[model samples]
Target: MLNSTQVSYFTLGAYFDTKQVKYVLFLILLCLYVLIVGSNVLLIMVICVKRSLHEPMYMFLCSLFVNELYGSTGLFPFLLVQILSDVHIISAPLCFLQIFCLYTYAGVEFCNLAVMSYDRYLAICHPLQYHALMSLKKVALFIAAAWITAFLIVTTTTSLSFSLPLCGNFINKVYCDNYSIVKLACSDTTVNNIYGLISTALVVFVSVGLILYTYMRILKVCFSGSKQTRQKAVSTCTPHLASLVNFSFGICFEVLQSRFNMSSTPGAVKVLLSLYYVTCQPLFNPVMYGVKLSTIRSMWKRLFWVKLK
Candidate 1:
């Protein structure tokens, strides 16, 4: 075991055996990253410029788009660089910082989705009071709270990780993750583990529960209401629900892989699972929302048509 002070770098072992296909993987990821950024930015710009979209639901959608950009920026740039490099090494500070950004991204995602669910619940279930319930000021506050709370919560986890006396420097995965870092610690990580559970339950599980509750209520109202109401609800709710399920699956799969012993799992499978959350969600959110939401789609068409003309 090396002294904690002497261990300034950690080696990433997930990319160890993929040297032969690094360039191929690099090109694929680069294109995907560009698409995620381009699509997200375009949607965000449309929301900001179009006065017709100045509503609570679109506000929440804007926040979601920006969050996707934030999360992907934290990861894709570093990942692109690593894909072309021979060695997969990260400094200790950078490793922890990456963990902080990525973990905070996940937490903020849950919060944003929870808030969006609330927005939809208000809009559909209590249409008469939707405007009063979700004013512009209130929406801004919710977005701010989502970002601030995530930072504070992840700050605790990252600080705890920084204090650990690491006995090893090899991280078995591609990116820096909370559990992976803690697993390398020389000392017992009881506190980190307990704190991790508490944070996950508080942030991920609670938000997921809230989203499910909102959807349940929405569904009930849809069934009780007329056909037009049902159609409207389906049109609005489909994209949000799809985004939620996509993100939840990615996060859950990564968590399950981390918690269990999957040594027998093929390396290729492991790589795919690891990349799912960071890569897919960023790309998925913009595409889902931009195409599914009617207002955004119409606005997009007009914006492009005018640009071309």
Candidate 2:
């Protein structure tokens, strides 16, 4: 483990030495990154050009696409380089920064998804107040809050990363992460690990809870109204629900994979799982929302035609 306080350090482990799938994995990840970025970029261009899509849902989606872009970026490039290079070298500071970027984007995106889900809740459950509640001013404030919260979480996470001392094992997953990164330090990862678990659980639980609760309330309100009202409410909430379910599944997979025993964990598998979190999951957001929403489709067509014109 290399000490975080040390001016510098060298990597100690080989890349999946016996694992033959490294090249295949690298190619697969590269393809995923391209699609994730391409899809989100297309969505952004669509919203920007379609004057009719100047609505709250599309605006929220635009924010999500931005989050997915940064989220994937924080981890994929480094992973791709390391996989292709056969060189397991990364300086401590650079590693920390990488984890910081990854965490910040992940945090912000989680909050934004909750906000989007809540917006849907309002539209379905409280039609009378939806416009006022999700007004431009309120949405702007929410966006600002999402950013502030992202920074605050990053501060806590980074402080934990910097405070830890690593010495013996420097191996980590392909996707750089706070806990895995901190484990590289020779010192005890107890503090960092515990902090990660608590922080992650709190964030995931809270955001997921709020979204679920809001939807539950929406279902209740819909049930009390007409048959048509109930069906419409379900239709309105379906996109938000589907997106939330997928997001939850990704977060759950990451939590499971990241909990390797610090003493005997395999670095190669760690890298593979980390790659899954960083690379495989982000496009899920764009797929769930961008493809399902008709308004987004119309907006895309209009935006592209306008651009060509």
TM-score to native of every candidate shown: 0.97, 0.85
lDDT of 2 by residue, 1-309 (tens): 345677364463536663567788778879988999999898887777777776677788788788889878877787678777766787767776777787777778778878887888877777798888889788778877876888787888898777766654455455446665565666667777687778777667788888878878877887787898787766556766776666666666667776745446566555455455456557876776666676666666665798899
Pairs that clash in candidate 1: none
Give the candidate number with the greatest TM-score.
1
Best by lDDT: 1
lDDT of each: 0.89, 0.72
Q: Please, what are the lDDT tens digits per residue for candidate 1 over residues 1-309? A: 764567899899888557678888889988999999999999889899999999998898898888888889888889889888888999988888899889988999999999999998998899999898899999999999999989999999999988888889998888888898888888989999899899989998899899999999999999899898888888888998898899889997898788899999987788789779878999998888888889988998897899999
